[model samples]
Target: GPGAPAWAYAARRHWAALSPPLTGWMGHADPFAFAPEWQPAPGVRRLLVGTPPILAMTALAAGVASFDGIDIAAAEAKSAALVSVFAALVAARCPGVGVDAPPQPRHGAQLVVRHPHGRRVMAALIECGVIGDFRPPDRMRFGFPALYTRFVDLWDAVDVLAGVIDTGAWQDARFDRLGKVS
Candidate 1:
């Protein structure tokens, strides 16, 4: 009775409930069986390399995340330049959009814009094929990775964003409803 598997099963269930949905893909096994106390279960690879690898590369190139102490001066300069341009545009056109004066660097080359109509603005951008993440009640975030993102792309996105704000297109009732995933 001392070695009963009931305790382990209960612990597993508790962990599963707290973890993300993707954890199910990792399979059921004694996680502590590995030497390091944690390791991916054998033969249970979902996003081991492909997308994560690409995103890692992108983050490194964006000068937001460092790799092996190597500093990317160009990426840093480019990010600053882009942020300056974005801040200027946002300030000039969309007065309601709040842009930080001294932008925080560790945020990974992204602008954290807070607006009254954050969700609606995000929805409008999505409609225009400009994807952005929203923090409910009023915060929209935009990340510009210097890897494949170009100035033209940013300009175009800003143009669409400006149009949305100017036209008050984000006032749509559809944007007020919450979706499965924000």
Candidate 2:
């Protein structure tokens, strides 16, 4: 649509947004190429994104002997499977709850559930010793790390959550009350 602005096009091309009337200095080139000397002092390094093959190639090119946090191909695949299972379980057993996205373990599975008392639901879960991040109004995100999480953990979490909902424990005024970020 002609009504769309120029920044929309920039976003589609995965370029950084800039004000109207783009300048030549707006990320047109790789900054690293322009300033090779800006490489950080050698130390332990990690990258949260990029394909395994690409990350491996970069590590080899940089002569990195060891790196932490980057998942091996097999491990990532396995973790993704685990995340799928957890998401599926949550979706099946919990009403008004659904997985946030395709079940992937990039950072573990994120489950999204809708509750009128979203904050209270989250607070109750936390009190039950099941920790998950929450957003205002109504968004609860639970992460199941493949490396440390067990199938039983998922089963137990769902059991606890179902109890909370069924018992209406989340309706407690104390739970409904906001806390710092909650």
Candidate 3:
């Protein structure tokens, strides 16, 4: 971390001191301390190339086609798939779960899945033994990561919601009082 900060400082200083030697300013291209004016080579790229490892030293080097460090694209794809699968499952199992994908144009808050009905739906899920959260206005976000969650869990959650909605449990008197934040 210190090294990173020092590198940034040095970069700033290097750019600051890039003027011609006739400007009479020290340009050491270093961050530790400033030095007396030194002329930089004209037409020099001044590029600090990161040292190359080229490839990992493992014997399977030839077949290493992937760079999986922080694979956000893959993560996002998997997340989308999970959400889709869960939403489908909820739709199939609990036909009355009401996704709020109504005829009206969806607000950003709707995209967030936070609505009064969203909270009720979440509470209904919880009452029937499924864990979930509700955002403000109206949103119901569920995470069902592949290689992590089972499809049966989605089914079970839907079943629970269906039961709650069927019983009108979300409309019960116990849920009448809104929370302070609500």
Better of 1 and 3 by lDDT: 1
> Which candidate do you rate higher for TM-score, 1 or 3?
1
Segments in model 1 whose C-alpha atoms lie over 4 Å from true places: 1-71, 101-106
Regions of model 2 farther than 4 Å from truth: 1-71, 102-109
Q: Pick the candidate with the highest lDDT.
A: 1
On the 0 to 100 scale, the lDDT of residue 52 in model 2 is: 33
Best-first order by lDDT: 1, 2, 3
lDDT of each: 0.66, 0.61, 0.51
Two-way TM-score contest, 2 vs 3, winner:
2
Residue 148 local lDDT, model 3: 51
Candidate 1 local Cα displacement, residue 18, angstroms: 17
Cα lDDT of model 1 by residue, 1-182, tens digit:
22221112234435434432333223434433544333334442321211234555565566544344545788787887777777777878776888744545655678877788888888888878888788867888887776567888878888888898888988988777545555
Which portions of model 3 show Cα errors greater than 4 Å? Answer: 1-78, 100-116, 177-182
Worst 10 residues of 2 by lDDT: 41-50
Instruction: Give the Cα error of residue 165 in candidate 2, in Å.
Output: 0.9
TM-score (all chains, Cα) for each model? 0.59, 0.55, 0.45
lDDT comparing candidate 1 with the true structure: 0.66
Among all candidates shown, the one with the greatest TM-score? 1
Task: Write the residue-wise lDDT of candidate 3 on 1-182 in tens digits.
Answer: 21121112234446644544222222234423445544343322223322323343242354343433647676556555556656566666665454544332222211123335667767666655666667666676655554456657767776777777677788876665444433
